[model samples]
Target: MTHRISCELAEAPLAPGEVAIVGAGPGDPGLLTLRALSLLEQADCLVFDRLVSREVLALASPKARRFYVGKASRCHALTQEQTNALLVRLAGEGRRVVRLKGGDPYIFGRGGEEGEVLIAHGIRFRVVPGITSAQGCAAYGGFPLTHRDHAQSVTFVTGHRKGDGELILDWSALAVPHHTAVFYMGLANAGTISRQLQAHGLPASHPVALVERGTTPEQRRVITCLGELVATIAREGLTPPTLIVVGEVVRLADTLAQPAAQVAILAEGEIRDRVGERVAL
Candidate 1:
């Protein structure tokens, strides 16, 4: 079967000296959008991060100059200032720079900060939103972020901070019942996150799902509860790129989730169609 990946509605050719800040979606290479795929083919320079999957990076133009500016929890390949400066320098040299980030660039990916810097420097730029981790992770793990029966709203928060600083999240608001709370980059702070939520009045038995390497072949959806979150993570040896989803909706995973291997084999059209319908609500 000829799987024709269409670019019929592609955007205008990427202009020289313009920065295209694109989201790489979650780990699945299949989630790359037509626009994001087009930019990868046209970019003169590709700046990507750690969370971006190798399969997605392989899609970039062979002639494109690749620069890895990935940052781990405590280790940064290039400081934020350095990355911003690099983008400006690349543009000044008349390069069509593609700043690819894992998940949606705007959602906790610091695309906004980068865009502000570009604007300050009077640089032309475009942002192509990708499937945020919360969306991709939840969908791949087979759970809804919001459900009329389970949750009324969803909140996304980061669980760790630079150096020895603690995560300053509004636990009281997060502890509210009938809502979903997702913690990005929360694996390391699982103990604190679980403890804080419980302390803030959420039931100790509150449902929690730790999605590791979400939407990829290595994906592991560890179903547990708030009380055992820290222990579960340690027992499973889960790593970064794990999204922590806490709420009653997690219980639906047993019935809703199709494993990543199963989902990965589906046609692109089928994947998009199914995911689109779920997200529209």
Candidate 2:
């Protein structure tokens, strides 16, 4: 099977001894940018994260060497230091390397830290932006991040805590009305998130949307209130990789959601099954 991509801006090749830190988007291969695809096809060494979908990886050249450096809550295949060293070493060997991260590399993907390492070692690299999980989950989960009547501002927050420590954040600012707050990797801190927002100013009845494995065939979206976030997760058996969106904008999902179940069925049945067949020729 042979495939060719035609684009006027495809002339810039991945030069040897350079690294391309590319975002793999939020699970969906179709969400990948053309520049990201180009680099994947040209990469000789691919370093990828856990959240990066296998479908996106399948689009890469089969000849490329793959290294999985996925990091989950408290479980890491490779330490951040080791991953940094690996990238530096690979680029030093004159390899066209691609560091594939889930969602936008700059949006809490640790691409900035990696970029700093590359710069310190004088390694040439480029960053290709992809759709962040907040955007992907919000769109696919059938809600707008911001609406004229619901929310006027949107904020992205990290839900990760340090060794079970308290989540230190500006609850006063976050609890303001007419603003949407999206928490990444926040499933574990649902109780704290709910409490803090209410303690500051927001009501317990604030609408919250829990999107599990968002933008994928297995995606699940649950609408609840801030007070019930913790209980909702337990009841629904939700896990990590879930996003928590807190705002009135989530109410729109009742009328706007395209039915996550149907979307999953179509993605698994038609899209996933036929993507290779259509693109292989």
Candidate 3:
């Protein structure tokens, strides 16, 4: 029951003074790449985010120094500038530093920005990509991002607005048919997302799926339509780390879903009562 990598294709060890910007894919330790696991095992210092699962962290070197720099809406353990500076200082100290992110570092995880800071300071670093939330959520939620009959293309969007300002995105582009749109950090703006897409020509009854805490044991998949998206979230009490998937492909979940003990699937007109009381929609 021991898994081993062949010596011929063995990963290079993380060197001293080198920063490894690694992705800890979508709350599932099993989804981690061999390179990411190797780097984590070799890392002497780890600066990680909130979404990086505890199970993933437990795989790292027991002696590694851990720093929590998780960011949530309106709350941050450390600012982006401070995190960048911390990486620079850690690398300067000749430590095998790992800047672990929740999903693919480059996709909305701000790995590019952090890399720029590292380069500016003449620090050595390497990026190890992880499976982004969109892919993870789609697969685990029993929906495909693209299908020949449903969707031809997929788009990833950030649902977070800039400090009380409106979400300024190309509505016409997003509301197109035969396309899947996955929004990250968008739980707060569910109403706006529902309205904008509708205004842009997408019907109110367009299929939508909300995957909460995707890829984790507590994962919940809520199946609803664009018009009832806001209400669905409120009724389900879905929280942050949820991914909003809007497209016809979401309807495929009814037939394609794989049963899981921990996953709860709630579809329109048929919702499970998690609490003691049942409230029909």
Give the TM-score of each candidate.
0.90, 0.92, 0.91
Candidate 3, which ten residues in sequence have the lowest lDDT sum? 267-276
**What TM-score does model 3 achieve against the real structure?**
0.91
Q: Flag the better candidate by TM-score, 1 or 2.
A: 2
What lDDT does model 2 reach?
Answer: 0.87
Best of the candidates, TM-score = 2
**lDDT: worst 10-residue window of model 2:** 272-281
Clash number by candidate, in order: 0, 0, 0
Model 1: per-residue Cα lDDT over 1-281, one tens digit each: 42434445556778899999999999788889888988888889999999999989988878999999999976899999999999999999999999999999999999999999999999999999999999988887788999999999999898877789888888899999999999998888888898899999998999998887777766667788999888887877778878899999998876776534345634332332122122210
Q: Give me the candidate number with maximum lDDT.
A: 2
Instruction: Give the least accurate 10-residue stretch of model 1, judged by summed lDDT.
Output: 272-281
Off by over 4 Å in 2: 6-11, 259-265, 269-281
Give per-residue lDDT, candidate 2, residue 268. 70
Write model 2 residue lDDT over 172-267, tens digit each, in one string: 989999999999988888889999999998988899998888777777778889888898889878888999999999888757765443464354
- For lDDT, candidate 1 versus 3, the one ahead is 3
Q: Rate the local accuracy (lDDT) of all candidates.
A: 0.85, 0.87, 0.86
The order by descending lDDT is: 2, 3, 1
Model 3, which residues run further than 4 Å from truth? 1-11, 260-281
Cα miss at 72, model 3 (Å)?
A: 0.5
